[model samples]
Target: MNSDKVLDARGLACPMPIVKTKKAINELETGQVLEVHATDKGAKADLAAWSRSGGHELLESAEENDVFKFWIKKG
Candidate 1:
């Protein structure tokens, strides 16, 4: 999905990445996608949980090399 905003959370740890993502998502409109890139291993689970709690949609998640990418759609 084409993202409306890109959040570079690479090298950030747990909670930080998820926190930043939540902030970004809050600024987006419904149906807009936010792309988050992070190196933290906890980002995958943390982001997923955050998305669920916020009623957002996790469109896709993948890892490339050591970086993790999450495509989240704002509700």
Candidate 2:
């Protein structure tokens, strides 16, 4: 997925990824996408819930080489 900005949160733990993601998404306009790269094991669930709670759309997710990638569209 295409993103307006990419956040490299790899090696960051829970809440940290979510924290940075929140900050990154805030810099985007509505309908823009934020692509996040994280290594946190809990990032999948954390980000999924965070996106839902914030009314953002989690467009796509994948695990590549132990890294979790997410494309979130700002709502």
Candidate 3:
């Protein structure tokens, strides 16, 4: 899917990815998609939980090499 915005949170740890993702997602209108690239292993679980709690849809996620990519649709 196409993303409206892209957030690169690679090399960050813990809540940084979540924090940046939140900020970036807020900049988009409803129904828009945000693609986030993060290297933190914990970002998977963190973003998943954050998305659910924030009422956003976690459309897709995948791991390539050491990077994690997430496609989230704003709700």
- In model 1, which regions exceed 4 Å deviation? none
lDDT of 2 at 34: 97
lDDT of each: 0.92, 0.96, 0.95
Candidate RMSDs in Å, in order, are 0.7, 0.5, 0.6
TM for candidate 2 is 0.97
Ranking by lDDT: 2, 3, 1
Candidate 2 wrong stretches, greater than 4 Å: none
Cα RMSD for predicted model 3: 0.6
Candidate number that wins on lDDT, 1 or 2: 2
lDDT of 2 by residue, 1-75 (tens): 778999999999888999999999999999999999999989999899999999999999999999999999999
lDDT of 3 by residue, 1-75 (tens): 799999999999988999999999999999999999999999999899999999999999999999999999999
Deviation from native of the Cα of residue 31 in model 3, angstroms: 0.2
Off by over 4 Å in 3: none
